[model samples]
Target: GAALAERVAAAGGVIGRDDLAAPTAEWAEPVRQDGIWVTPAPTRGPALLAALAGERVLVGGPTGEGTSVVAAADGEGNAVVMVHSNSHPQFGSGLVAEPYDLVLSNRAGRGFHPDPGHPDGPAPGRRPPTTLHAWALDTRGTGRPDLFGATPGGEQQVPWNAQVLGDLMTTGPDDLGAILTRPRWSLQDGARVPVEASASAVRPAHVLLRVTGTGLTAAADPRIGAVALGV
Candidate 1:
């Protein structure tokens, strides 16, 4: 973990806390926002059984906003997009960084304890996994992007982006500002937080977009410090 931290720092990434101690409990619990409290318990048994019996079960929960994403486009139907993050900012190996390559820290757990049965379960000296991603929609066979965007929140990345995509397709194809500024939501396994323009929900991450044939115009969520430039 220490060697990985040195490499990440050399590559211009930020390293936060590091915990080398043993885990306190057998299973990790879901972390909620302030004023919320719940017990840490093993994943329910029937839920697993039902899933094995071909029943769909929703899993996962909210996570820290340790990822960053960027996109760029030029005339002539060319575009490029990138999404990145440090996984859990405050837990797991407690290393908040965006290294050029992948991570090699014990903090890969991202606060979720190892479940021997799960695929993403924690193991020794494994690269911390992440859901960080970038998206660009293609119109038929055309390579140009009809819409492209990225978000930083861990588990909220997909859910939040889904909302943005739905709205962009339905209401605000050209209104990028209006689309991103609208209320956003984050949900995992039925736990929901109607994220609004506040510190926790709005501060850490936001959408950045570039639309083709929009006359060199670009927009970024004001809630974040990202900027858009024209070449």
Candidate 2:
């Protein structure tokens, strides 16, 4: 693959060096809100979910966004959910970042509010608020989380996760597949403080969900890729 990638690069192809190296980065601190762990600002996911959970938080306006969400769990009650995104409207910034060759997100310019007074205001070295976020739930009163998942529906990420989680907790895990397969709704702009009117807009935002029961049980939107791959 390395030789092929070198040949491709030499031939003016887009494929660069295949980097199988371990991903390394300075750990960003996490914040807790209403007992849920959130990827802190300038990603607005935590604030959005908190607002939905009836917290007084400030989450600036929405903007175009894109992302990929992945989650996995083990029998020992360990789980992880990850979400990655570019700014919006396809390849963000149109600039390939180093190492990963990622299309750097134009988050600061596009997602952050222009006004400096805003909580989500952008500045040098500051990331803009993003809709990319993962959510988890522990309904069994155990110290570990039994249910968790994420999605890439722009502002719809939180709403979908919240709705599904509510059902999963209320109706029990037996109906989980049915709850996920059922048509879901997304709030308008993913309102910072959702109201009755915000529920006006509704649609099936194709999202993959990973649930850990006896082992790992994955439920994905039928309108999308294979569930086994969690695409």
Candidate 3:
């Protein structure tokens, strides 16, 4: 709210607390390509869209890095696309629920800056950065739809989703299970995880492989114990 107040005061706009309290959600028309329809969840959608649109580019596969999925289907002549993610890493490790097999991790409590001028700085109930996302796509005039989601820390998800989508479209994989299983990720600092089949794949320098996909395919980071399945 302080950000809004600062902006309003700077622009001489008549904004008040009531205006901020009554904010409403907005839904724009779905984005489509060919017979495919896509929609992204809030926040992370724009970045994912940019990656898919070529405004941004990524040159690897999605593994321990973060990622989102887009599903497409047709219906009588309409297409649809959807994207979503938490956009942050798991900050809490103890909050687990077995009934639904859910882990109640704190997502929106990251990316905080200690600067008092920032909006997320030292707030009483501020949410942290989230890393979980859901992305979907549907084709025009069709009933079937494809959905994708992932849990990797921020920024990483964008490229992760793009790579998976490319695999689905260009290579025609039956499911993302295989791709996800053997996925690899590179950090912003140029350190890659789950080392690929290169000399650098072996480790002691970086994180070691936690889970292995199929032969020379993919693997999860052992640190996280994430799993992938193929049929």
Best by lDDT: 2
Off by over 4 Å in 1: 1-62, 90-107, 111-113, 122-129, 139-144, 188-191, 197-204, 211-215
Each prediction's TM-score against the native? 0.58, 0.66, 0.44
Instruction: Sort the candidates on lDDT, descending order.
Output: 2, 1, 3
Worst 10 residues of 1 by lDDT: 31-40
Ten contiguous residues minimizing lDDT sum, candidate 2: 195-204
Q: What tens digits encode model 3's per-residue C-alpha lDDT throughout 1-231? A: 555444445555555566567656667554545433334433454456666777744322222332333333333333232333332232232333434545433233344545657754545545433333434443122444433333343445555555655655665444345555456553454554543532322211111111112221222233244443232
**C-alpha lDDT of all candidate models, in order:** 0.52, 0.56, 0.41
Error of 3 at 206 (Å): 22
> For each predicted model, how many residue pairs clash, with residues at least 3 apart or on different chains?
4, 0, 57
After superposing candidate 2 on the true structure, give the runs of residues whose Cα lies further than 4 Å from its correct spot: 1-36, 55-65, 74-77, 97-101, 189-213, 223-226, 229-231
lDDT of 3 at 155: 47
Candidate 1 accuracy as lDDT: 0.52
Rank by TM-score, highest first. Answer: 2, 1, 3
Which model is ahead, 1 or 3, in terms of TM-score? 1
